[model samples]
Target: MAHDHGHDHASSTRTRLAIAFAIIAVVLVVEVFGAWLSGSLALLADAGHMASDAIGLLVALVASVWATRPATDRHTFGFRRLEVLAALFNGVLLTVVAVVVAIEAVRRLTEADPHAPDGIPMLVVAGIGLLANVAAYLVLRGGDRRSMNMRGATLEVLGDLFGSIAAVVAGVVLLTTGFAAADAIASLVIAALIVPRAALLLRDVVRVLTESAPRETDVTLIREHLLETPEVVAVHDVHVWAITSGAPVFSAHVECEEAVFAEGRAGSMLERLGECLRGHFDVEHSTFQLEPAGHSEREEPAHR
Candidate 1:
């Protein structure tokens, strides 16, 4: 029963990630071609946004696969952290793309005779991108929001949606007022939107790599909860982090009322505690040290 449930969950996640990547890649290709045909900076900006979305979705998909790879003697934790690294890399690349786009847009506004032939193509491409983004967002919406990897994919879709809207508005302005400069202005606005989101994602990915606490969990609160149990005396060396994106893992040393000989009861209680973590807090991996009152301090603790 438990085995089938776990397999089904993993399969569902994999299928969703794959679909999102497919949508992003297809829409991005269309936007790129549309931008070339229209010569509209706003359409190009949407293309750039979609290009980054494709990369983000690819990273998320690859991470999902890597996360399931079996652990080996050479790599104890498997490849789960690759997801965090991929997210960080995606953020950096997106930030760079945004900066380059902004600078180019500004330069074109000053030097080039920036003129768009017609607003129709821009409007059409933007509309398609908007629809694709919304559909992708719907697919990823049910996953764990605290998963930085998943959050990266979600933000990419959202960025594409915003970029599409900006393109549509620029098209409208060009059609009505002959203000081709609106296209350039829209590009800059899209770049500005990308900057903050990329920076925030980069910060979160960095925190995870540095083994900082997971953003959604509080170590102190977890310790307090453990201490509330009758047999627990104190909790120390408590560490908490995510295994992949949605699966949090924790390790800690808990002082107990009895000696080390009381392993049976302690083990059962810890098992129950693990179940509670999975049910309530979405923690998938847990390792706890059963220590006598002062036994933890007497010797070096084991690392699981």
Candidate 2:
């Protein structure tokens, strides 16, 4: 039953991602043509961002679809982690695009008699691109925003939307004042906007890849909660981490009174401990290895 629910969620996310990708892909084609016709750096930069966003959305869709596969003996967790990898890739790609755009903008700004871009065409294309991005954003807004895959796709669309706005503003300035550097300036602004968000996304992806605990989880508090269990005497080797965006996993070694094993109460104690974790920490998947007091000395535990 739980498995079916998860599958449905992934399917819904994939559908939303597909819709967004199609919109971005169409807008990308139009923007590329407009950039070529107008020779506007702002339009070109926005197009490049849109291209990256289209790729990001495609990756997210593939990852969401992959996540629906059942786990196999050889791959116990199945393909859920693929979504994290896709998010990391998307962040890195966006960062690279931003850097390239910034460098090109600088070069254009320094050039002598930089050609005046066709502001009218830029305005028309940017307006169209903005509308398209807004549509994509609306499509994804209702989906799972907590998932890194969905978040990555959303981030891309948001960046593209901002890029479109910058392009339109630059177009207006270019048309009114004939200031050729306005296009370059807008490109730089778009690049600047992308860098911080990309960096934050990359940081989150790295944290997950490293198996660090989720930011919202506190290991000490969880250990304390386990110790509060009547049958539990001590808790050690507690570890908690996110498998993906919304899926957190927990494992720990819990020492209980020796009577728990002798009286056949270990099973009940384990269930109670699981309940405690679920109720207090919102952890749905947990593994607790119940051990008798002083058992750690016999086998040499990994951590105290």
State which candidate has the highest TM-score: 2
Clashing pairs in 2: none
Q: What TM-score goes with each of the models?
A: 0.85, 0.97
lDDT of 2 by residue, 1-304 (tens): 9978977887888889999999999999999999999999888899999999999999889888887787899879888899999999899899999999999999999999898899999999999999999999999988997899999889889888998999999999999999999999999999998998899889889889999999888899999888888978888887888889878899998999989999999989989998998899999999999999977777754585
RMSD of each: 3.3, 1.2
The C-alpha lDDT values of all candidates are 0.80, 0.91
* Model 2 ranges off by over 4 Å: 298-302
Measured by lDDT, the strongest candidate is 2
Q: For candidate 2, what is the TM-score?
A: 0.97
lDDT against true structure, model 1: 0.80
Model 1, 140-160: lDDT tens digits are: 877657557788888878877
**What does candidate 1 score in Cα RMSD to the true structure?**
3.3
What local lDDT score does residue 222 receive in model 1, on the 0 to 100 scale? 79
